[model samples]
Target: MLIAQISDPHVRPAGQLYQGVVDSNRMFEEAIAHLHALDRRPDLVLLTGDLVDEGRSEEYAEARRLLAKLSIPYLVIPGNHDHRENFRTAFADHAYLPATGALHYCIDTHPVRIVALDSCIPGLHHGHVDAEGLAWLQRTIEADREKPTLLMLHHPPFTSGIPYMDSYRYIDTAPLEAIVRSVGNIELVLCGHVHRTMLKRWAGTVVCSCPSSTTEIALQLAPDAAPASYLGRPGCMLHLWDEAQGMVSHVSYIGKMDGPYPFA
Candidate 1:
């Protein structure tokens, strides 16, 4: 099975730009187009969060309008920029989402199992999974200990050297890490919110944080580095799963580029 992961689209209303500058909606359109143009079509698409810029209904409407161009099966979880109720109402047709509380669920139909966690702290930018959410995860993962699983959450589990961004990560990760460490069947833990590509070996598996479809967060490692971002080579994550290869991931950049030259 193959899955394409796109994060932090931050879609604005029609005629508006993300943060009133970058044309994130158009960029997201390009990302959808890129996915559609892949050599081998993906069986599913995973949207890691921040679907809309400000959690507004109009933004979600515009997002849905742009999303009309995509025809693949996709799953989405809320990010800090998303309002839970508004997001829930926006995708009301997605029956997999819980009717109330955190937007966490598990999908078992594919060759690889998918478990998505809602990490947003309502009106706050930082994230956390309360005891209730963690309890649900523990039960879900514990129920099926042998499936090739992927854990999806908005926040990457490690403290990325991007100091400014790390300030907004999920608080108190000890418990979540414990649950993940207890499970050996989880092939990878996929995340977003850092807006740049990141990888780490964690909990006896791999954790991959995808780049945004709109902007690339500056990779500053200094302790006092200030927050900054740019509209650079926006990209997404392509995860391929097979019995022999397991989960192999690649960062697929968007927009046109000079390539396919013969090996000299």
Candidate 2:
């Protein structure tokens, strides 16, 4: 199984730029084009969050239009930037985005189980997985242990070691840790909201985050670092899974650049 992950497009109502720097709409289109052009098309496209900047109905509508170009099946989750009601209203026809419940779901994809958990807290930049989401996650993972599971959510459960990002990471992680430790089948925990590629480990499972399609956050390695944002390269993550080889995840940036040739 192959999965293409796109995060935090932050698309506006009319392909408008964000903060006069990020062309989110165009970047999203380029990312989709890159996905389609891959040698092996993905089985599914998992959009982590922040599909829109403000979660407006128009933004969702616009997102729907942009996403329609992709031939692969896809699923979306709400981020701190997204409005839950708007998400439901926009994706009413989708079987996964129901009109009710916690906005969290568990999907069984044969040898692989994809669990989309809602970690967004209303009116806040940071996020957390509440008790309800935690319970659902625990039960679902406990029920299935042999299958390779990939947990997807908008907020990462661990800190990215960056100043601005670490402060806003999933606030309550004890329960999350317990759940992950008990599950044993969780191979990868995928998340967004940081707007940069990050790798971490939690409960023996690999935690990975992809860069936003629109913008990239500057990497800050020092503690007590100031909140500094960047206009770095836009990118996404591609996850390849196989029964024999296990799971492989890689990062790809969106842009045209020439590479040095050894022969030349």
Candidate 3:
């Protein structure tokens, strides 16, 4: 099955801009339109995190409107910018995130099982997976050991080398590592909170963090990194997987800009 993994949309209301330079809502609209235009649409659209700009009701209301236009099924977990209650309100009809108010859930999606975790620490920018969430994750993975499962969360369990961003990652990773080590069927860990794309591995599972569709974080050297912005590209990933073929992911940036293939 093919899954479209879109992360860190950071969507604001229409015509609402963040700072003087970021037209986040417009960027997200363009990206969603791109997905709708795809010839062979994805089987599912998995939004890793950052559904709203500031966890505001209006922001999520606008977000809901834009996302509702997608033709295929979609699932979203909470990011640092999302409030659990507001997120639940926006996705009230989603089976995984019931109206009961919990922002986490697990689903058996054909060949793959997906476990979505809520790592948002409410008002904090940094993230953590508390004992309850961890326990649920352990039980969830243990229940379905044969299927190739994917764990989606808002924070990476490891450092991404971009020091500024790394500081805001999951504060405690030992417990997460233990759970991942025990679950042999976990194929990948998908996350997005750093506003930049990064890939790492933990307990033999691939940990991937995709870039924000609106922009990107600068790739900076540690000592000199000093909280800065790079304004890189707007993009998303296409994840292809099956029992026979396994999981393969391709990252693509928006091609609306006229330019030559720089690498070639």
Candidate 4:
């Protein structure tokens, strides 16, 4: 099975732009068009987080409208920029999401099982998985140990070198780490919120952060480099799972590029 992961669209209202620069809605439109045009379309799409620039109801409504155009099934989790209530209300058809409390659920598709964890702390930019949330995760993973599982959350569990972004890294990771190490079937931990593509080995599994569908965080790794972003190549992660190769992920940049020139 093939799964496409898109994150950090940060979709703004119809007439507004994200951060006064990015036309996030347009970017998402292009991203969706790219997905639809793929020769081998994905079985499903996983939207990690940051669905909108603000947690406004109208923003969520706009995001929902755009996402509805996808031909394949899709799932979404809350990010720091998302308001749980608004998101739940907007995507009411997504029954996996809890009506109240944290938005967490387990999806059992054909080849793999997806365990989505809610790491968003309301009214806060940083992320945190409290004891309760961690406990839920532990129980969920422990219950299904044989399935090839993928853990999805909005925040990266490890510290990224980007100082400005690292400051908002997920807090209280020890519990989640312990759970992940204990459960050997977890194939990958998928994350967003940094607005850039990053990969790290943690807790006996690979953690990959998908680049934003709208604008990308500058790859500034210096200790003092301030936070900045640009409209670089928007992208998504395509994960393929099969009996032979297990799970393989590829970064697919959106939009058309130059010709497929021969290597000389």
- Among these predictions, the greatest lDDT belongs to 1
Best by TM-score: 1
Q: Which residue runs does candidate 3 get wrong by more than 4 Å?
A: 100-102, 257-264
Q: Which stretches of candidate 4 lie over 4 Å from their true place?
A: 262-264
Which sequence of candidate numbers ranks them by lDDT, best first? 1, 4, 2, 3
TM-score of model 1 vs. true structure? 0.98
Work out how many backbone clashes candidate 2 has.
Answer: 0
Task: List the candidates' TM-scores in order.
Answer: 0.98, 0.94, 0.93, 0.97
TM-score, cand. 3: 0.93
Residue 246 lDDT (model 2): 95
For residues 82-200, could you state the per-residue lDDT of candidate 2 as single tens digits? 99989888888778765686688888955678988988888887888878778888888888899999999999888777877877778878888888998678989999999988888
lDDT of predicted model 4 = 0.91
lDDT of 3 by residue, 1-264 (tens): 888888888888677876558988777777788777776688888898888888889998889888777777888998998888888877777867856634778989567888898888878888888888889889989997888988889898887787888778798899989998996898888888877667887877888887788878888867657877756788887888877889988786764766657786
Cα lDDT tens digits for candidate 4, 72-146: 899999899998899999988888888899999999866899999999999998888888888889899999899
Least well predicted 10-residue stretch by lDDT in candidate 3? 95-104
In order, the Cα lDDT scores of the candidates are 0.94, 0.86, 0.82, 0.91
lDDT of 2 at 240: 93
Please say which candidate is ahead in lDDT: 1 or 2.
Answer: 1
Task: Give the distance in Å from residue 144's predicted Cα in candidate 3 to where it truly belongs.
Answer: 1.2
Between candidates 2 and 4, the lDDT winner: 4
